[model samples]
Target: MELDGQRKSDNVEDVRGRSGSGFGQGNFGRRGIRFPSGGGGRGLSLSTIIILALIYFGLRAMGIDVAQLLDDGSSGSSSYQQQSNASGAEQEMKVFVQRVLASTEDVWTDIFEAHGGQYDMPKLSLYSGQYPSACGTASSATGPFYCPGDRKVYLDTAFFTELSRRFKASGDFAQAYVIAHEVGHHVQNLTGVLPKFNQMRQTMTPAQANKMSVRVELQADCFAGIWGRKADDKGLLSAGDLQEALNAAQQIGDDALQKRAQGYVVPESFNHGTSAQRMKWFKRGFDQARMEACDTFSDPV
Candidate 1:
């Protein structure tokens, strides 16, 4: 949680207060999703463009039709000005997210290099209210999602507030876990696991698709643990940092979300695993500290 001296990642896109129209039920149909390209438009950085390319190709390979994935609008320049209003604490949190992202870049870069592959870091888009993505219109209510169609992770900072206030998971490390998990999804995409899962979804029954989703999410939790382990080895983790992340993993488990939302648990619809399953896989990654060891598909959870 001590990011005082850590390097900041340049991959963050701050689009707070930038949406001019509602992405809600009434106006959602008219919103245009932004698909990044290399030309003058928005001039997304190299990382963002590569991520988008990966997503576009991945979706295309899965027969998802990248053109169909896009919404109807274009992202010219946002009319909303950068807030002159953020407090110091909010700024600090933004910096923390950047630092955590940088940490993942460091850890994954080395791991990929060891395997003779290059790690392509994904861009993190920070938006408030609503945002346009290759996946579709997204609001804070959709939570943090890595859109495979855009190869970028979309997050609403207010979700972190909800993570603390509603989920009872509050700590810098806990927040870092969220970012790490989303990055984990990017890792899966790069490794072709995501495409495979997408292909499988076409033929899977609803129950089977949900099961695959659980495995996908649990694998991501393990990847977060792997990052935590590496961070701890570098002395970046404090005494309770790992515990905080684990608590967060448990806090957002499918069972936990369902319980919090509906006051009951439904195992069949659990797409993110239960609390125990989440905590167990995270521990597995922390103990093993390797991507190969975090394979949840072959091992029963």
Candidate 2:
């Protein structure tokens, strides 16, 4: 996790405390933020949009302000500041994020070129509280996610704090694993796997859809492993870094989360695979260090 000498990526958008209202979905199209173009995946429907609008606006009307919770104008305890840019430890964290993202760009771009295509790197949006997205409203509670709709990855860095406090997965490498996993989703979108999954999910039963979701998440875990392997090869990983990544993979597994939340596990509703499955797939990718070797769909978990 010694990213001191690493290059920083410029493909980051720092919207940490920029939201004024966090209302109206921020007029995406009007602001030159285009809808999801081409055949990557289906964007949210109009009815879904209406529902989101109602849910958001209704909360505002009832004085149940979720977005306002993010607006901490106080300087001392706040994680973000509207007027000032990132500073102090927050600034250091941003640098670390950029470095990790740059490493992914280096590794994935080379992999993509070897397979006969250019990697259109997905932008990383660092935001706090809430932000309008082409997919939907992204909140801190949603964790880190890749929005195929806008070809970007959204991260609430506060989640890193949560990762340490709640999940017991605390380390810079663990945080890198989370970022790489979401970037792995962007990989799926670019490689045509995501669109096919999206198309098929429409015709699938709830159980079937959940199964597909597990595969999707597991594959992303594998991709994260692939990045980890490359990073280790580049001498970027420390002695215990790999274990930290693996521990993180295990901690966020569907079964692990379900067990923690409800004191039991439900396999049928598991969309991100079990703890064992996540560890296994990640190791598979790390061992092989080959994209072809990470194919969890046809090969079985």
Candidate 3:
């Protein structure tokens, strides 16, 4: 990833080291607690949730029904938003993220223009602890995600450390893959695929909906690979760069994350694909270097 002399994107809003807009002074706790405050609204109280989970289980042991208590409704919940600022080394990384985003803009714009479609550039919001997005309040723990409602990408730079230290998928390209995948979601949003998926999910069973999510996520991975191949063709990829991105796709596979977290893998609960599936789709996009090659929904994922 030789980013020297590359054009940096102007669409980035860096809010690394600053305080949040509504949330006042507070320290991050060891239990991974960081409040998400937005427009003076009450935050999602993790402490309260934990206490409720304990009481719910306690009642279940006492022969009381606790069906709703065990429900994982947190998936649909969004944290409140907070203001932020950036500085020093974070500032450098901010520039790097902008450059990578600019490269994606360049690659995708050319690809779209070649297909007789206009490419609408997306904004990248860099925050520290938490931030507000069209989808909801984004926390650093959510990693990097693109909000289709706002057509913007929310990234917490701390995830770069997770890539290198925890996920063992180290390298600038790995980080770039994360961003590109989120942009890939934006592509789906623009093409009406995302909304269609959302509508279809409403009528599908939980298992069926999870399968659709896997296909959607895998398609995004393939799109990231498409961008990687384009970067390689343009001489932007250095040795091992492709592997860096591929390793990231594999590392974040649903199977891999589930195994690490729970010591088991449940296919029906998988929202993202397995490592093999992820690797396969990414390779598909890299081999073809075209958006049409990433049609995971049309075929069996």
| Candidate number of the best TM-score | 2
TM-score winner between candidates 1 and 3: 1
Regions of candidate 3 where Cα sits further than 4 Å from its true position? 18-86
- Would you list the C-alpha lDDT of every candidate in the order shown? 0.87, 0.87, 0.85
Regions of candidate 1 where Cα sits further than 4 Å from its true position: 20-87
Ranking by lDDT: 2, 1, 3
- The alpha-carbon lDDT assigned to residue 187 of candidate 3 equals 86
**Candidate 2 C-alpha lDDT tens digits along 71-178:** 455445444553345466678888889999999999999999999999999999998888878888889989999989999999999999999999999999999999
Displacement of the residue 238 alpha carbon in candidate 3, Å: 0.7
Which prediction has more favorable TM-score, 1 or 2? Answer: 2
Q: Can you write out model 3's per-residue Cα lDDT over 1-301, one digit (the tens) per residue?
A: 9888899999898866554555433542233335465445675467667876798789989998766544444433341111122234676898899889999999889998999999999999898888767787888888899998889999999999988999899999989989999999988888889999989999999999999999999999899889888888878889998899889888888899998888999888999899889989988989999888899978777
Clashes of each: 2, 0, 9
Candidate 1, run of 10 with poorest lDDT: 75-84
